[model samples]
Target: MTGGPSRGARGGRAWREGHAAEWIAALWLMLKGYRILGFRLKSRAGEIDILARRGRVLAVVEVKRRKTMQAALAALTPHQTARLVAAAQQVVRGRKALQALEIRLDLVALAPGRFPRHRRGVGA
Candidate 1:
C-alpha cells in the first residue's frame, strides 16, 4: 500500500521553506548594506534567525514567513522576542567581532512576490 507523506516529511518541507525565506531575507539585508554575520545562531537561550552588522550597529534579525506581511510581522510573541534577545547576547559574547557593535533587534517579514519588509530596532 502506498502511503502519503509522513508528518516528518511535511515538517521537513516546512523547515526547508523557512530556511529558504531566511536566505532570501539575508540577501535582502545585504542589498541594504548590512553584512550578514550569522544565520540560525543557536545557544542555550534560544535561536536567532539572522545576525548582521552595519557600521557600529549589530542587528539581531528574526525572519518570518506567512501568507501576508501582517501575519509575519505578528508572528513573534513576547516570550520569543525575549528569547531572541537573550540568544543575541550569548551570540555576541561568543564572537569577539560583534563586541563593539550596538545591538538592536530587527524583524524581516517575507511573503510571496513581495519585497521583504525590514523593520529595524523592533522590540529592542
Candidate 2:
C-alpha cells in the first residue's frame, strides 16, 4: 500500500500551506495599516482566516492560495463567501470592541511568483 503519501500526509501538507498563506496574508494586511486581531479564529458558524482592524474599520479576511490569480479568486465560492459573512457576523455579535467599528469582507489571494493580492469590500 506504499504507492504514494497517505491521505493524512496530504492533508498535513495542505494545512502547512494554508498556515503559511495565512501568515503571509496577515503580514500583508499589517503592512497596509491593519492591526491583526485574530488568526485562524474559530466561530460557531465557521473558521475566520483573519480578523484585522484599522482606525474605525474592522476587516474579516478570507485567504486563498492557488496556482494563479484567477484560480485563487475562483477558490472563494459563493457558498464559502456566505459562510464567511455569517461567521463574521456571528463572531462579532457579542464583542463590544468590534461592534463600534465598520465591518467589511476582504480577500487575500496568494499565487506563485506574484505579490499577495488584497481586495477589500469583497462579497458585500
**Strongest candidate by TM-score:** 2
Per-candidate TM-scores read 0.93, 0.94
lDDT of 2: 0.92
lDDT digits (tens) for residues 1-124 of candidate 2: 8899999999999999999999999999999999999998888889999999999988999999999999997788888889888898887897977888888989999998999999998887
lDDT for 35 in candidate 2 is 98
Model 2, which residues run further than 4 Å from truth? none
Q: List the lowest-lDDT window of 10 residues for candidate 1.
A: 1-10
- Model 1 TM-score on a 0 to 1 scale: 0.93
Off by over 4 Å in 1: 1-4
Candidate 1 Cα lDDT to native: 0.92
Candidate models: Cα lDDT each? 0.92, 0.92
lDDT score of residue 21 within candidate 1: 97
